[model samples]
Target: MHVLELAKRRKTVRKFLPDKPPKEDILKAIKAAKEAPSGMNAQPWKFVVVDDNWLKAKIREACEREEEKFYSHTKGELIAWLNAKGFKPEKPFLSEAPYLILVFGHTKAPYWLHSTWIAVGYLLLALEELGLGTVTYTPPNPKPIKELLRVPNEWKLQTILPVGYPADPKPKYERKKLEDVVSFNEF
Candidate 1:
């Protein structure tokens, strides 16, 4: 499928089937992600693929704790929007998905955060191409998860992607028009 079509079709999958996807397919998506450009060729991104049920449970618990804190503090339209979207503090998808890809960026690298996010975009599209589904989930606080996963201090957590076949029906949302976001060399 065309890249734009694939992008349009790719939706954030919160509910996932229990079946695990092939490791080879996951690797292929990672390979595509590696092809993304990095600042000064540092390639300062690390992807940890977790499939262990125990680890997933631990991660889910940590995430839920942080999410609860976040929901309590955040207010106004953001909270209302989250509620309208059916998002709650409990993140069942974290444990329910067959796999979790934890993306990290080396803090010392130049433009590491930006470069890493570009790579993640590549990963998302690649997974879509391979018929897998995921959501870009970032906990309000990542320090506990970093320790739980034994990630080095130099590597900062970016996002967690829960991977599997989507169990929920796809949601339809509209995107902003190209003209609304574009510029003719001037604001």
Candidate 2:
């Protein structure tokens, strides 16, 4: 499929089937991710693929704790939207998905965060092409998760992607009109 179509078809999969995806397919997506451009060619991203049930459970517990704190303090439109979408402090996907791809960025690299996110975008699309599902889940505080994953201090946690075959059908979401977000030269 075309890249744009792949992008459009890729949705945030909250519920996933229990079946595990092939390791080679996940590696293939990572292969695509590594090709993304980075600042000064300093490919400063690291992807940790987790498939252990015990580790996934620990990760889920840590994420839920942070999410609880976040939900307690946050208010307004974002919370309302999340509530409308049936989201909660509990992060079941962490344990339910067959695999978790933990993305990290080396803090010392210039534009590390930006570069890492670009790579994540590439990963998401590649996974979509390979018929896998995932959602970008960023913990409110990554310190605990970092320690749990045994990630080095120099590597900052970017996001966690819970991957599997989607359990539910993809829902259609509307996007803003291109003209509404576009301009000719000046704002």
lDDT of 2 by residue, 72-152 (tens): 998999999999987899989999999999999999999999999999999999999999999999999999999987888
Model 1 TM-score relative to the real fold? 0.97
TM-score of 2: 0.96
Q: Please give the lDDT score at residue 56 for candidate 1.
A: 96
Provide TM-scores for the models. Answer: 0.97, 0.96
Which residue runs does candidate 1 get wrong by more than 4 Å? none
Poorest 10 consecutive residues of model 1 by lDDT?
A: 166-175
Structure candidate 2, residue pairs in collision: none
lDDT on C-alpha atoms for all candidate structures = 0.94, 0.94
